[model samples]
Target: MSGDGEEDASLEFTPTWIIAIVCTVIIFMSFFFERFLHYIGKVLKRKKNFALFEALLKVQEELMLLGFISLMLSVSQVSLQKTCIKESLMLRGLPCKRESPNSVSHVTFVRHYQTNFPLDFTGMRMLLASESGGSGHCKSMRDWKSWEAKIQQEDDTAEKMVKHVHELQFIKKRFKENKIFSWLHSFGKQFYGTITIDDYRAMRLGFIMMHYKDNPKFNFYKYMIRALETDFKKVVGISWYFWALVIVFLLLNINGWHAYFWISIVPFILLFIVGSKLEHIISNLATKVVDQNAIAIGNCVVIPSDDLFWFKSPKLVLFFIHYILFQNAFDIAYFFWILTTYSFGSCIMGKKAYIIPRLVFSGIIQVVCGYSTLPLYAIVSHMGSRYKKAILPHHMHETFDQWLANAKTNKLKREETSNEGTVDKFWGAWNRKKASNKTEVVAKLEEEMQEVQHEPVPEIEIGIHN
Candidate 1:
């Protein structure tokens, strides 16, 4: 009891322990009483309680970092706990008396992961069966074909699974081809009149040389919008001023603005650097890469638009099925807006709007961006468009065909009415001119040229010399 000294020296409260306790409280509040906290925030905001509102948001941010902090703490403790007992045994990988989470080797962790995740045995087995290249996990997966390992034989269902060893091997083989493997193997047959795994492997060889489909997007504004949507995260972070403001705010909040006012100069320089010509080039580069790889995969072009799902084949049946999913509660943008406004804050400063807050401006921007970003917004907004029978008789291709038809019609009209003439118009003008020349009717052009040539140059006086 005397050796304990009323408790171990490690049990004493420190800054780290205090921080951990605070984080635990915040995480608990965030998880259990999120709505209540928001309500309290709204009430505080309405009453113009600045300090409390700011404090609440600070806690919210702590809640965001809670998971990350917990992970770091666990890892740190595992690597350092043995040092508490003896100085000489301060080795990083020293094991504690109890089975620490760190003691669970990578293989054990992965086994647990494969068993629990996906919540479906078929999916778990399929994922485990994937040939992760040359990793030790591959060896484990290979060993799964053997009789000793029980993972291949175990099932949650009370009904007895196949007891035979060969049956397990067959299931393992079946799990290896989970995705479009059969379909990928069929592509050579569909295109080249050959169906084999060899053909699929051969397709991989031409991966470097494969060409992608490119959209002939003549509309600059529309194309630019699409580009922005594809990589909005990258585009938004281009502003050095935004980063400067963020850094300054953090420094001031952390170390008292007056105490380290000079510390802000560095961020100001960064902001200035961002607005310079060099920063402009970086911004342009980001914009260039925006949607360049949208529909590109390896060297192959998957689809014309980045709006569609990546893995889904661009077939008529699948396209309509995707459309049905779109129609049914695809209000993801609205959800984001609500969370940002209510949970984050109405202002850039994390304060309530009360007046013309940032949320209002952001809402407008979000609506514009979402509509420009995808045709689903338009199709969904237009009620009864889904049920328009004449447009899509079987709904096989669905609103996608309707959208395309409208797009084509608008494109044709733009071509007709645009001030910038097309290739056809240029050729037509050339042909007409040729016909006129052949008919000997070029007098107007000759007279115009002669008039230009014969026109006298006006004499100008220098300063007051005239």
Candidate 2:
């Protein structure tokens, strides 16, 4: 056991630089591409908006893209390694039993998950239920119960109102049903009615195709394009700066520093051009393309306190590592493997394979493994901002600040007008206990008074007879 413990510790501490190298190239290239997007956006907003520097940023963006893609493809040429069971990349898959002298296995999905990954309140159910937390949800059933405790703790009228508001917000954002998942349920309801690692495996584009058989109102292609556009923005928009920081951090643990010197040059140059310029451009573009989604899904009745921002950091961190990293790693691995199963993609499935896998999967692996999680999150911020139109009814929609302010106003009026209900309203157990105690005291006093009122006449008659 001791020997096994030491071995496990050793493996955990061993940094995977190959992952860093791949991610560095993707994000480094993405930074410049996004800068070009920003430039284009700026010119559209107004030509005088940094037109002189546009040529330079464009040239830089182009060069980095070329260099990064070349290097990434080269890395994929490394000696044969085992592919994840979830992935079906031609060079690494089981069908390709023959080992190639030059090929990269990369990290497998199962192996990455074996590492002790973490998540949060929103993500707790999966983690606690994963075989990580013992017998999974079968044992404790803690996920749904955790929220019950939180709700009960909030006793006051105002606090309870806010709690209700936050719950609504949480549902809309965190526990949202996927379009594919919902569509599947609808299809099943139409006929049979039914519902992870093995979930999205065979069905590559999701159950959307099956859904098409039931009802085809939604343009799945348009929906995909929207999702992909958000991903593209994340990989190459103003979000690229976040990607740059991520690249530097990953590169820190890597061995061959000089190989990345040229790569680092452009990100270093990018720092100078960044200011309010890109921010302004992106904001304008967002007003058109993204903010509409935000409006559709904005329902929070409690304005967060300014100090809550600090605490939200940790929550956001857990959310990322859990939902995005863990779930996506498996989902994307499955997606990549399915390419071989696709009608035209069957050529890459079996042995005698000569094809080189694309770095697109490599990029997906890095983010899914929590490498560039923050930056990738920054890029896809808009997608997270919006929800399906049917999610929350318009009447139910209320901003946190709006609801909070209204609650405060009502609370103040009630407090000033009469103090009668304040104790019952705000206090949870203490007020109940107090009311019970008072009732007991009153009943005891009344019993004593009745005894006194009746006892004297009987006693006086007895004394007179004696």
List per-prediction Cα lDDT, in the order shown.
0.33, 0.34
RMSD of 2: 25.4
Model 1 steric clash total: 0
Q: For candidate 1, write residues 1-466 as lDDT tens digits.
A: 1355435434453357676998999898766777886887999678754434554565455444544645665566445433335423322222112246567665454343233211212221112112111132223223322322332243424454334321332122222232355334322222221112221212212221222113221122222223222222222111345335434433342211221223323322332222222212212222322334333222121112222222322222223322222211112222243354444442211223222332343333233223221222211111110212222222334467788899999998897776456766888999999998876656877778899999998999778655
Worst 10 contiguous positions by lDDT, candidate 2: 193-202
Which pairs in model 1 have colliding backbones? none
Show pairs that collide, candidate 2. 34-236, 78-103, 88-337, 188-193, 196-199, 234-379, 303-400
Model 2, TM vs. native: 0.20
Worst 10 residues of 1 by lDDT: 125-134
lDDT of 2 at 81: 34
TM-score, each model? 0.18, 0.20
